[model samples]
Target: MRAAKSAYPLTWRIMDALEAFAAFVWPARFGRAIPWLMLAPALLLVGLLVLGLWLIGDASLRTLDTSTFLMSETYTLANYRRAFTESLFAVVAWRSLAGSLMVTAATLILAFPYAYVMVRTSSPVIRKLLLIALFLPFFIGQVVRAYGWLIILGNQGMVNEALSLVGIAPIRLLYNYWAVLFGLVQYMLPFAVLMLAPALTAIPEELEAAAGSLGADWLRTFRHVVLPLARPGLVGAGLVVLTLSLTDFAMPAILGGGSQDFIANAIYDQFFRTSDQGLGSTLALLLVATGSLLVGLVFTLFGAGTLAMGRARQ
Candidate 1:
């Protein structure tokens, strides 16, 4: 009985010591609120997105009965089949893909040199002015910008007038592939510059200086040092531009001018013009799928580029 009483007191004292230490190290009550506060917004956003997607999917499954404009009943795959078998959808998809690729490539080619100069130059005034100029177009609405392009590219517009002054007949520039390409590049160029500028700035100056000292010229340094470091930014920017160009309805709708159409425009036409909700849903889903795939590919490339860069540095 005496031994048992002694052991109980010792065990209780150890437990009290552990409890005091834990309380001193970390206050259990205070930390609970922080995680909950941080998690609330994320949970709310996820719930809303899931709810919205579910509603869209539900609406997509139902078909409109022509007898009554409001009457929609039955689920069918006919809409999906129509989307695939129909030349209109296929043509639009192909055009969107091709146009997006061209626009992305063009933006990269144009923005890279500009971005490099902006990052490497020691002139603050020039850099600030150029940065402001790059972002100025975004201050204007896309529709307004599109209309401005219309004025510039139209037959009776400034470009044609200039050509006429030079003794050349007004060439067809508006409402064509070139016009669309021009508009897309103009819109996407700023994004490319913004992405590339940061990446370029992140590159250490010593790398370039060392390369020069070792007999590597500017082009060689850029190829060996700058290009590899900038790969992630390039891939990210390209993906963003490509996706924007692919889904962009306003540019194609305005500049394409019945000559061309993208998947987004096709979706718009189905929903509003033809009253084909099912088909439109399928097309929308396809657009989402394509965007997801493009994003996945970009991240994969980015990961590989990052890993390769790390290995090269080692």
Candidate 2:
């Protein structure tokens, strides 16, 4: 009649040992350093990021010599110049940017209602169902979900079969600009709902009731009170969705069928397909800059909002 052992006894023992070892190494006077010690992992990650940036920047200045199939030793701005001047790059950049904006807007629009209903519903069953609907897709990997869309939207797939039942010919659905955007909006919807749910919860239901009591209709109350208060959440969700959509590689690659290209796909082509490290490095660095600039721009306009956990403005 022995008690069951801990599920991860070895891991627990190792952790305890590490704690003891850490305590042993520290001097009594260094007790005050515990706070700083907590930041070691973050500092290490930052150091690695800086190192990576330095490497990519160095590679970007070196052009690939097609003649020798090697990167040039001498640093030059040829890669940067080409990136700025190229029409292909411009097209890909524009597509990614525009798609990202559209996806963010559409996802937020769809997510707001979902989040509102989830937050406001009184019944536990409804709340659970909504949560399942919101989170189930997250468990499915992005690439897998993209493939699922392929199955549903394929010319000979379910939609086509349904169309055939009604005497309609099978139409092309996948591998188009709208298809890509549609997939992106679907992919980003869950993220938007997760972001917005908390913000909706933070708003007092009584205020909404009070608005209704004061002769304001549902539309007016939503427009003035709910909308204004939810601004932070919307901005935060929009920023997340925009950045993710802009940099997505799989959706554009798989769904576009090599026709539509995003900046990320372009970067992948440069690095892997073309075997041009210089060009790839240039694109990677520019992508980082673009994403940073966008985030900075959002912060400047919206004051960081819920992305900063409602404490940014405070």
Candidate 3:
């Protein structure tokens, strides 16, 4: 008790000195201008987001006429009811969720080996070239990329032509579930690589070497050492792919045709084609909520901090 009392005053004195120094430095370096400089971008982003939401909400609140094909201000939940009951919006939402999950799972399986090879390879030049190729597709606009898929998957396109030459009938590839999945996986592959690469690279070589020294084979070392170390990256990559697929509009709009309608496309139709702004907003909000919940669940299950600590003990 006496020793604790003696330390308490010293701690208080040190804290006071730190506080005084902070006050002097804060005014001298930041004063009024620095805070504004730091805050401006954040404030601007918030303002824009709020404004956009407000505009969408306002548009949704207006009533639409089926007779004259006109919209007017008579706020109601009829649009929301119609979205739930009449439009098969619920089915679209389910499809979106399922498609996102499938794409995320497939991308994870595909990307893990590539990411592991990229990080673990001895050839730096080859790794650099491969990374460049992986990310190169991102430089092209999404619309162009989607159209490229269309050309490749179309009846008279490269894929069909090659299949025709093989004497097999041209497959019905375009405007289908497979086409949408292919496009989504291609679009999100770069993200998976980016997320997984850093985590793989950060794993200490000593851990793998130690495992090997203990008579563990390469496969065993990977199973026991590398995978556990990279679980966080796996989870993070899945979340990115899942969220992107969930909110995706372009690929579904272009590749899905009538067969692959997602929630985002449904929302677009409501706002633009049907002019049911309120229902669109509600759908948008639902998408946001669902994405957030899934992301939160992933983090809860495989957070980086927990996984890191688990690996450290091994």
Candidate 4:
């Protein structure tokens, strides 16, 4: 019995010694570095993006020679000039900017109520139903959703068939700017709701109740109390929706019928259709700048509405 007890203690001692040796060898002693370690993947991603941007920036300074189907070996500002001066580029850029803004606004408006209800609702069944509804689209994928819209909105599809039953002629729903916007709004709704849900969840319900107790109506309580607290989520969600909408290619491609093109569509046409890497790179860099500017503006204006969710208390 004494020998067995001694063996157990000796085994524990050996395990402890191995652990100490491993810790010493690895030397991950810096508690401060844990945060940096957590951020390593993000930092790596950003670094790759920076490298890609640098390459694009270099490419943007060159012009494509249509005759030779080759880029100019020497640098030039012709691509940038063309981006601003060309009517096609201008129209596409304007459409993308306008669509992104509109989609962001619409998504936020729709998502807020949905997120609020999802967070505040007492019934498990309703919450589950809402979650299922939101998540169902995720499995279907963006391309599929866009295609689903195509099927539903096609001349002979369900929507047109339903309209024909009412004695109305089949309306052209797909292959237009409005169709692209509708698809974008539908696609972005779930993302916005997901972002807003956590922010809504963070707000204490007691604050709303207290406001009501202090002679505030439901509307006033929402406007004054809940809205202010939910700003972080709203800002985060809006930024995500805005950036995504601005860069979206598929919806515009499928729904726009090649006429109502967004910036991404234009970029694709420049790169793939025309094989003009110089112009594509220029447009890509410009998009990055535009998106960065928007994010900078938001961060500058509202310091309260940070992207970080439940940041470390320290």
Candidate 5:
């Protein structure tokens, strides 16, 4: 046995030594705890999050005493009421909700085809190029991307310059709702494509070929087969895009040029701009609740498959 151990490769010997040390430190009887032990960090993080939320909730119940520039001792729902009643807050909320829906729809529509081609295409070069394009923007910061759009869509930018050569005037493309939405869509496309790719890959090409052999057209095959199989990815991507867009700040701030603002921007204005921590806490809590409710709705309607694999089996 010693000779046999000595004959093993150096890498294997090291692995054996590590295993032996681990077994000695942690006995086999406690093996079941290993899973829970590994989860300790996550549990700690969740506990901290809950603690922070509790503190915020407590703060939200109190009102900011503007006269003294401090929070009041008595609890009140005034902050919550103000959030819903204020026209500025209401408009920002509506804009965020509307923008989120629009961005989600556009992202899914644009991403589905890109992801489908990336997964289904036989050409490695095209796949590589597509992957490169998708990930290249992902490496760049969202703030940087917003600034890039400003350069490209500005009055003196490349787009307007090209139009000038054709005897057209520079259009007001930047600093609007559409501009903010465009920035969000551009930022989210990669994430949507990434989420959808695995789902598309899971679909067997042989199924499509089989459908074709049975005289079904490509569109019919895709509608009846591929689309159904890819629902999990679609739902997941939609949820991700919706939540992100709803809470986005940088795009609206940078691209919308002070006129357009999302819910996150509103939250920021409360906390920092106006120095109203109570209102900020209320907004933050509401945003969390809204996101949680939306996610719960998706899960309730679509099952866990909206965020996981195994939807096809269901």
Candidate 6:
């Protein structure tokens, strides 16, 4: 066995030695100890996340004393109570929820055809162009893109400039609920397409051709065959888009221009503007919980996570 190992390439020998060291350090009873060892960095990151969550939870339970402008020594649920009882918080929460849903729906709708065209096109030029368009926005930062929208949609900007030529009045496009949603949809489209592309790629063109030969039209083929096969991607993309839109700060902050506040914006205001760390922590913790819940719900509806898509039987 030692002679056989020596005959192998140096890289393979090194890997074998490393695997043996791992099996020795971590007992074989642990099973696949090298893989577990490889995950140490990720596990440490998760540990740090849990510690931060604990700190946030502890802060969430404390109440601020307005008199001293400090948190109460004793923990209480007053911040949570206020979070639930406040009308403004409710409004912001509802707006975020509704806006995220709309963003997810619109993003998926727009992304599907783009992804489909990119994946199914026989023309290499068409595929490359589609890919370039999809990836171009990714190179631009989200904040920059949001600001670009501001430039385009501003009253005195190019949009209105063009509108003026067409005999249309300068309209108030920025600083509204719709503006925020539009920004979110734009920000999320690339992500949706990237996620959908893999699933769509997994679907063979032969399957689509088979459907067509069986007397199924385009729409019917998409509805019965393509849509069902792409469930994992849709679920994954929707969850990502929804949670990101829900927790977004930049789009609402930049585009909404202080009128439309998402949950993250509200948390920011609490932390910075109001100097209410306790309330801010409460909102932060609640946002985490909400995002986790949404992820869980999506995972439950779908089979598994994006990475776990083809490994269900395993």
Consecutive 10-residue window with the lowest summed lDDT within model 4 = 305-314
lDDT per residue, candidate 2, 176-270, as tens digits?
99999999999999999999998899999999999999999999999999999998899889899989998999899889988899999999999
Error of 3 at 210 (Å): 1.2
Summarize candidate 6's per-residue lDDT along 113-189 as a digit string, tens digits.
99999999899999999999989998999999999998999999999999999999999999999999999999999
| Model 3 spans with C-alpha error above 4 angstroms | 1-37, 54-62, 66-75, 304-314
TM-score, each model? 0.85, 0.91, 0.81, 0.91, 0.91, 0.89
Tell me model 3's lDDT, rounded to 2 decimals: 0.84
* Whole-model lDDT values for every prediction: 0.84, 0.92, 0.84, 0.91, 0.92, 0.90
Backbone clashes in each candidate structure, one number apiece? 0, 0, 2, 0, 0, 0
Candidate 4 on 3-76: residue-level lDDT in tens? 77765687798999998998887676676687888999999999998999999999999988889998899999
Write candidate 5's Cα lDDT for 97-168 as tens digits.
Answer: 899999999999999999999998899999999999999997899999999998999999999999999999
Off by over 4 Å in 4: 1-14, 20-24, 27-40, 304-306, 310-314
Cα displacement (angstroms), candidate 1, residue 40, comes to 2.7
CA displacement after TM-score superposition, residue 181 of candidate 1 (Å): 1.5
- Cα lDDT of model 3 by residue, 1-314, tens digit: 35766666877989999989989878666676887989999999999998987777676665677786676657776666766686588788888999999999999889999898888889999899888988899899787999999899898889999999989898878898888988999889888988888888889999999999999999999899999878778877888889999999999989988768999898888888977666778778778779989888876776643335446335
- Would you give me the overall lDDT of model 5? 0.92
lDDT, model 2: 0.92
Better of 3 and 5 by TM-score: 5
RMSD of each: 8.4, 6.0, 9.3, 2.6, 3.0, 3.9
Ranking by lDDT: 2, 5, 4, 6, 1, 3
For model 5, the stretches where C-alpha displacement exceeds 4 angstroms are 1-29, 311-314
What's the residue-level lDDT of 125 in candidate 6? 100
Predicted candidate 4: what Cα RMSD to the true structure?
2.6
Off by over 4 Å in 1: 1-30, 304-314
